[model samples]
Target: MFPIVSKLPDVGTSIFSVMTQLAQECGAINLAQGFPDYDPPLALQEALARHATTPGHHQYAPMPGLPRLREAIAHKTARVYQVPAPDPATEITVTCGATEALYAALAAVVHPGDEVVVLEPAYDLYGPAIRLQGGIPVYVPLDSPTFRINWERVRAALTPRTRLLMINSPHNPSGAVLTTEDLESLAALVADTPILILSDEVYEHMVFDGVPHRSALQHPALRERTFVLSSFGKTYHATGWKVGYCIAPPALTAELRRVHQFLTFAVSTPTQHALADALETDPAHDQQLPAFYQPKRDLFRELLAASRFELLPVLGGYFQLARYSQISTTESDVAFAQRLTRESGVAVVPVSAFYHNGHDEGLIRFCFAKQEATLRAAADRLREL
Candidate 1:
């Protein structure tokens, strides 16, 4: 065998994939992965069906994106955030998904030995992606339970080598939404620094209890220096479509495109056309999302109310974290997750998996984006535990 050196030596298959496979094998209700157990909106599906057969639309999209789709994205951004619309021609880039957007942004900004400050427990990709670009990842733990950013700790983590700060609102595992005050603090912190921001707002429309998602683009000071990434898949319940976009200043867009052009080159063409049509045809689809998801979140929590698990508050996003210490004090998060899948017939992701070193905090995450029947069944199993 050839001697091959792996860039990500410590990395294995992602926990999402691992738990999902285990769920499949054990015949468990698979809630470990952060995807809905339903199809996209009927309008979106019909649009895709129409575009698929339309003549002359079967080729690669432009390097940036389909003009129509980019324009739709621009209009949506302005309408949702009440901020100036990004110039679709120069400031918005359609990517393969938010995954590609994150990687490309990191590749574009980080040089060897540059430090990227990341809030933990972050999405699993942040640390490894930074390292793959030869950038050092400086991890700062978020305040536990609430998963709120401690601005002072964030300020302390910065150094001359710091190049980027990665943040996710409606954070994964813990569904904590960042406040406007949080953005104001962020704007002030990076006011004089060369550091850029990567705001992952894929869950922008999923905030519950009247909490609005505060995008980085809304802050005038942060807007110029931030590369905001969002996913159409998350909003539309079409994760398999893998269509996401980035909004940045022209210069940053140019740099991100330098990497993005070679990364995926362009997203699927018919898909973009369909998305554009869907956006225009059903503009209120996103506006109705909180109403769509909040009931499911409440139902899941209510179902488990009598169980030993302590359910955490879900301010935004579809995931829910539960402290399982009362159920089993001896098992580590990983072991408990596996046992829960195998015996209780319910699969979950251990919160520790989000950390680089697998730091356990007695938490496991449940994806509440499933259908009513699915959520009910999972809850039934969970209640028995």
Candidate 2:
């Protein structure tokens, strides 16, 4: 057998999976993986069961998506973002998950030797996805303690070779949400440039503290050049369902479909019907999410208040970043995480895993997107530290 060079040569088992497996092995309360411990809406489950046996949906969904699902998404976009409802038939492509949508979008826009500007301590998938398309990922660090975009730094990274800028808001691990000014900065930076934007907004519905989520679709200049990817799983508390969609202009959608046709052909048929029903039945479900999660965040923080760990502001997302330097000065973030998982019986993801060079900032990320009991139990364990 011939030895083959790995495409993502440095890639190994993801930290989420590693931490989850360790949690399982050690009987730890697992907060390392970003998923809800509770079941999705009972209505959505019943809808799935009803639709799964329906004759028309038993087979494959259309390559772009189920029309009804796309329509639901379009209506939601129009209502939420206050933009003209995109033509569902022409502008939306349902994907297996936001993960696939992001990868397909990257494959569509990036060519060999092209560059993609990535915000560091970002999602782990961005760099590998860009690299797979033979594109270079030019990293810029987000301002720490706040994880806000440093627009000047982003501007400095742009070159004529740049093909795309990827961004995530209600950003993962950090819990920072983007504001309108950030969007305006981005709009000005890419003006008249050939760069495209891949906006990963899976956590769009989870902003907190009376702040509104600023979608890329809301900015005219951004909407013209951005491929907005969102996850239904994240919204519906059904991460296992893995259903997500993309919204872009006609031309970008056309290109995305070119790659998406081969990526997964279509998302799950019955799940699409279920999600469509969920959206139609309760358009305000997303609006209720922050209220639903805020108490849990408060509880988790209150439990940890007496501990040595200092919690950062969690403006959005279910994750919390805690600086652990006071407790373990000798260990790297990775070492600290592993030792904590084994000793304290609480698992977490080191924020360094989201970086290009594993830059440790003495911070670790905990997914608070769990059941209340789960959060309480994890907090109980963590308080022992």
Candidate 3:
């Protein structure tokens, strides 16, 4: 057998995969991964079905994306963010998902020996993707109490070798939304550095508490250098569709498309058409998501109030982080998660897994993207602990 690539040899099964498997075996309520059990809007589903039978949609879409979808995205961007509409031809490229778009953007920009700064605990994909491109990932930790970035630490991490910075807003596992001040700070830090910014805004529609989602595109200086990536899956509850788009300046978009064309060429044609329809006509669906999910969040919090776990503040996304220090003496987050799954019949992802050094502590992440009954059942079971 051929020897494996040494760069990624240390990477085994993902924590999500392993925890989900354990969750299945234990018949636990799986809150390990961030995917909804509920179906997407019936209108989107109907559109998909209609497109499947409608003539010409079955063929491969244009390399960038279907023109209608790109135009719809442009309109949506202008309507929601007040940004000028992107030229569908030169400034937009659709990929298999935001994952693919992220990968492509990284590959296109990062060179050998380049330093890419990523905030920790980051999404698992960022480090591996950087490593694969021969770029080093410099992780800056965001510990608790504030979960905000230390600007001084971020400045210290930058060097002449620094090429890009990957940031996620409405962040995963933490439910932290980047504030306007945070974006201004980021802009100040990267102003003279020639560093590219990849802003993952997949959960853009999920902000709560009247907080407006701050997009990199909304910042004038950041917009010039930023590649903004968003997923239709997260917005529309259609994770399996795997249709996502990226917007960038023409130059950056060109480079990303070079990698994207070879990666997936294009996403499924019919789904693109269906998403176009959703973006154009059913925009209200996503506009209401924050209100829709807030009740679930409140319900889950209410249910878990009596439990030993202390729920952290959730600002956005489907995730809620909780500290279990009172329930168990176990210091290891992974062990605590495993024990919870086996004994409490509720599966959660250990927050420590998001850190580079495997931070074993009392924190775990729960996905609240379940049906009300599911959330209630899981919360009830968790109360027994």
Candidate 4:
């Protein structure tokens, strides 16, 4: 019999999977996972079908990515951030999704026993991926009220063993966007350290209430050390397509590609071609994302106003966190989510699942990335609770 590695034994089934299964079994409205229950742009879909029939796009794309797609990403970054365009041939490598890009980046840079600093409540992938590469994940909790980083806590967590910092904004589950001042604070802390950064900006276009989305590439000092990861799947409402890219300085990109080539080698050819077309010809698709998502968020919030749950402040992303302390004395978030799914026919993810220490916060995360009627249906069901 083979022995199993014990680094990730504590991590078993994900909250998303368990809640989704319960939702299916109970015939409940699923608002647990972060994927949209809507289709992507029609034009992009048509382009993919058209490209599939074309003879030229049927073959494998280059190891880095299709040249045109890389160029389109470069143009988009330059236009939005006022940054220099990276060489498509050298600085961009497409991966299966932002998930794979994150894994590849960590694998390429982290040595065994190296400490990778993470911001929590973090996406579940970051900790496991770091551990799989034999690196330690050091978590610094974001303070409540604002859910912003506590700079003193962050500085205290840093040591000579720190090799990388993983950050996400506008953050998932919390809906907190990092401000320019926050970026400045990060830059100052790592200015003299040998640490690199992996910035997950998958929800880049979903900022609300006139708050601008800050890009890691926009900060001059952090640019060289940062590997900015983004997903076309999230931006285009096509999560199943699973196309994402990473941008970094050539020196850092070189290492990213070394790991990327072995881990999927290339993304889907037709999707890459179609995404290139979408990026070049349809800027309006991403430009209109906030308006597209804000109404659903507002409607969900409006519907929840009559319920016992108190809505937390939402700044970005398709998720909204709500405290359920008033509804029940049950302090366990996992138990609350399961009960809500079974009795109320509405499913949500426990917020405590995102934290490393697993502190029960009496909170749950509900995703609003669904159609108007879907959001309305989930809200209507929650009103009875």
Candidate 5:
């Protein structure tokens, strides 16, 4: 029997897992994790059921993904980004999920002592992935109240040892989407730098209020030096399907697949077939995503308006942020989240959990990706405060 040391000693269960478990334990309306309570599109579900019985789909897909799925992704990319379609065979690799793609991307790029710059209140996975590869993570806090990036601070954070910059738009917890100006500024900043980008666009199809998602793939220079990742689960409201894809330059794709080949080898076969059919059979599902989620975001905002929680502007994505400074000035974000779950019977993630230092901003994030009944039920519990 050998004594084992933990690689991620500071890491335990994720906040999403922790809060969701607590919500279940307390019999609360679970809004802590960003997942829909609704089913995926009927077309996709039917495709899955049909494909599952098909002979070839029961086994492994291509290491790069099912070719049909890759081709469909390529077509979608060309249409949305208005850029040259990446050769599906050489540049696109289907992943287990966006999480695995992101992990594989970091493993492909980062080496010992390298630094990866991250914008905070970032997704929790970024820092740990960097650290797992023996790399340093430099945190740059997005400006409070608005969670928008400051370019000067970003510029200051980058140095010669900086190997990667991670960007998440339609950001988790805050729902901040990157603007065109932000992209142009990013392109200018990285123009001469050797740094590569891991652009997390899982929420790509979910931008709201007529604002474009400004994908890294849309900028020629940025596209050349980036690994762009997105999720079918997000597009079709089937998150448990865990199907995602990565598009990079041929060389970068080669490097990522080297890591990804060992990481998961391939995503689910039938699910890939289902997503391919979903993409090709009805492009409107992705096209109408913003419209689909905007009303729910609005509904949540409207219903929660009377509560002591201050609603933050939701530019995109399914999550909403509520400031609790008005509700309770004493408790840390973690304590408030726990207490809120226990007393109010609604669970929300603490925004501070996304920060490395646990930098409390007196904010909690609620997942509005729920049923109308669930949203109303959660609001009913919350407004009683």
Candidate 6:
């Protein structure tokens, strides 16, 4: 074999993929990955079918995106956040998915030795993507249990080398939602600095209990400097579609597009048209997300209430974290997660997978964005524990 240098020497297969594969091999209900077992809304499926058969729609979309799609996104953003609509021509760039948006954003802005502050436990991709760009990831751990941001700790993490701060609301793994005050503190933190914000609001519509998912774009101080990313996959239950977008100021969007054009010049043309149709025809789809998902969240929680797993509060997002100390203190989270997959006939992601240093809180995360029957069956197996 040729001698090779690994960009991510310490990284291995993602826990999500590993656990999902284990679930498949074990014939277990897979709640480890954050994707619904069910299909997307019928309206969305039909739109795709309509466009897929349309002549002349298979060609490449504009480098930035389909005009109609970008316009639809801008309209949705302005309507949902009550902020001014971003210029579709200059401020939005559609990509393969939020994953690509994240990579492009980091590659565009992060130079070698620049420090990017990331809150942990973060999405598994955040650290690796930052590292691949030769940027240093400065991790600030969120408050445990609630998983809320600690602004003072974030403040302490900043240095003259800090180029960007990455944040996620309706946060992954923890389901913790950021409040308006949290955004205020963030705006104040980077007020005088040249630091940029990367706000990952993929789970924007999934907040429960009447709590709002605060976007950095909503704040005047942070809006221009923030790259707000949202996922069509997350919103439409079409993770396989791999479509998401970035909304930033024109200047920032230009930089993002410089990298984006080389990465994936244009997203799937037919998919973009379908998405545009869905957005315009079924605006209620976005509005109904909370009511649709909240019931699943509640039902899963109620079913697990009597189990040995101590369920944590899910303020937003679809994942539910449960402490398994009552079940086993001796087993590491990874071993327990694996054992549970093999023995209990259910799969989960150990919370430690999200930490840079493998910090285990004896907690495992369960994705609740599944069909009611799937959740109930998984809950039945879980209750046996």
lDDT tens per residue, model 5, 1-385:
9999988999989999999999999999999998999999888899999999999888988899999989999998899878899999999999988989999999998999999999999899999999999999999999988989899999999999999998998798788989888989999999988999999999998888888888998888899999998988788888899888899999999999999989999888988988889888897678888888999989999999999889989888899998988889999999999999999899999998999999998899999999899999999999988
Instruction: Evaluate all candidate structures by whole-model CA lDDT and list the values in order.
Output: 0.94, 0.92, 0.91, 0.92, 0.91, 0.94
* Candidate 5 lowest-lDDT run of ten: 278-287
Candidate 1's residue-wise lDDT over 57-146, tens digit each? 899989999999999999998999898999999999999999999999999999999999999999999999999999999999999988
lDDT of 2 at 149: 94
**Taking the tens digit of each residue's C-alpha lDDT, what string does model 3 give over 1-385?**
9966587887889999999999999999999988999999999999999999999988999999999999999988888899898889999998999999999999999998999998988889999999999999999987574577888899999999999988898898788899889899999999987999999999999988898899998999999999999999999988988889999999999999999999999889999988998888877777899999888899899999999998999888889999998988755899889999999899999988898788665789999989999999998999988
Q: What's the CA error at residue 378 for candidate 5, in Å?
A: 0.7
Native-referenced Cα lDDT, model 4:
0.92
Q: What is the lDDT of residue 186 in candidate 3?
A: 94
- Candidate 3 vs candidate 6: which has greater lDDT? 6
In the range 229-339, model 2's lDDT, one tens digit per residue, is 999999999999999999999999999999999989988898899999999999999989999888888889998998889999998889999999889898999999999
* lDDT of candidate 4 at residue 238, scale 0 to 100: 95
Candidate 1: worst 10 consecutive residues by lDDT?
Answer: 278-287
Candidate 5 — which pairs collide?
Answer: none
Residue pairs clashing in model 3 are none
Model 4 is weakest, by summed lDDT over 10 consecutive residues, at 140-149
**CA lDDT, candidate 1, residue 202:** 91
By how many angstroms RMSD does model 5 differ from the true structure? Answer: 0.9
lDDT string, candidate 6, 208-288, tens digits: 998888898899889979999999999999999999999999999999999999999999999999999999988778888
Per-residue lDDT of 1-385 in model 4, one digit per residue for the tens?
Answer: 9987787889988989999999999999999988899999999999999999999888899999999999999898888777898789888889999999999999999999999999889999999999999999999888974688899899999999999998899998899999999999999999988899999999999989888899999998998899999999999999999999999889999999999989999899999999999998996677799998888889999989999999999999999999998998845999999999999999999998998888777889999999889988888899988
| TM-scores vs. true structure, each candidate | 0.99, 0.99, 0.98, 0.98, 0.99, 0.99
Could you tell me how far off, in angstroms, the CA of residue 122 lies in candidate 5 after the best superposition? 0.8
Count the clashes in each prediction: 0, 0, 0, 0, 0, 0
> Model 3: residues >4 Å from true position, as ranges?
none
Model 6 TM-score on a 0 to 1 scale: 0.99
